[model samples]
Target chain A: MRGYSGDKDAYLKRLRRIEGQIRGLQRMVDDDEYCIDILTQVSAATKALQSLSLGLLDEHLKHCVAEAVAEGGDAADEKVREASEAIARLVRS
Target chain B: MRGYSGDKDAYLKRLRRIEGQIRGLQRMVDDDEYCIDILTQVSAATKALQSLSLGLLDEHLKHCVAEAVAEGGDAADEKVREASEAIARLVRS
Candidate 1:
């Protein structure tokens, strides 16, 4: 998130929306909604979260990792590794 | 999440904790924490989320999927597919 604060508000807003979606999902279950209906909502919520993750990844690459690379030392190596790991996790997800 | 109300409170609490952790990580980055240190916090926060995913997965399997399978029809097939897709996403992450 380092120098990526420019988009931080957007990220937070998206996350809040996702959170509301999740709460709606829980309420669907509580109300004993139809199975397929609930699943559809789950799919939507999951996609929203994945979108958030991708956005964060982009910010990390452009700001934090970019800074590390500019610094050119142990910091660079750490940031690169972290970014790679994050990408790997998202890809696996 | 269908039929999983028994542990709903616990899930909500954990999700709240994870949300807080994510905010804390963002703060760390904003405060110009060292690269590796921020990464460490990110790792912790990610693990917390993974834990929440696992819990939800368990609930889905035991309640939603289980009920669907017991019903023995289109519902069973749909639930299984949805659950499989969810697991696939989590694994990819």
Candidate 2:
């Protein structure tokens, strides 16, 4: 996750904005915003969240995961499994 | 995307596997696998894909996007817009 660590501040900022958007969406629901509108916002938030996750996963695979594989320990397989499980969870969700 | 470039070969291999998984999912659909099973596989494939995307996005934000922002060019804003739009598209899907 070397790439991830390089610009930590900016990434966190984006995440904060997305977090606020999610809260705003929740508030919209509380205020009885139109169904489609809420759904639309929900979709946006989901995408934002997904984008963030995608970025992190990409870094993991490119850096940490790859390094682990190169190192070739029990941890390497564990990392692979963890990655797979993460994907599984995403699909199940 | 510096981190991504560093281990390109390994990353491509993982992508190849995911690609195969997606093809398998398509075949399952063609064969009319049970709806739940098909859905399960679809979900898994989606998650696998999302994971891959997330990793790449993370690298871009950390490396490419961050460098663009740091350089302070028109490209910086363009990159930001691209990222936002990417997120929007994901949500819409």
Tell me each candidate's TM-score: 0.59, 0.49
Off by over 4 Å in 1: B1-93
Q: Mind giving the per-residue lDDT tens digits that candidate 2 earns over B1-93?
A: 373797688679988988898898789888988899978887787777776766665555545655565565577567656754554454434
Model 2 ranges with Cα > 4 A deviation: A1-3, B1-93
True contacts kept of each: 0.04, 0.00
Task: Name the lDDT of candidate 1.
Answer: 0.64
Query: Which candidate wins on lDDT?
Result: 2
Q: Which of the numbered candidates is closest to the native, going by highest TM-score? A: 1
lDDT of 1 by residue, B51-74 (tens): 666766777788878987998999
Cα RMSD (Å) between model 1 and the true structure? Answer: 4.6
Each candidate's chain A: what TM-score?
0.91, 0.84
Report lDDT (CA) for all predictions.
Answer: 0.64, 0.68
Error of 2 at A25 (Å): 1.5
TM-score of 1: 0.59
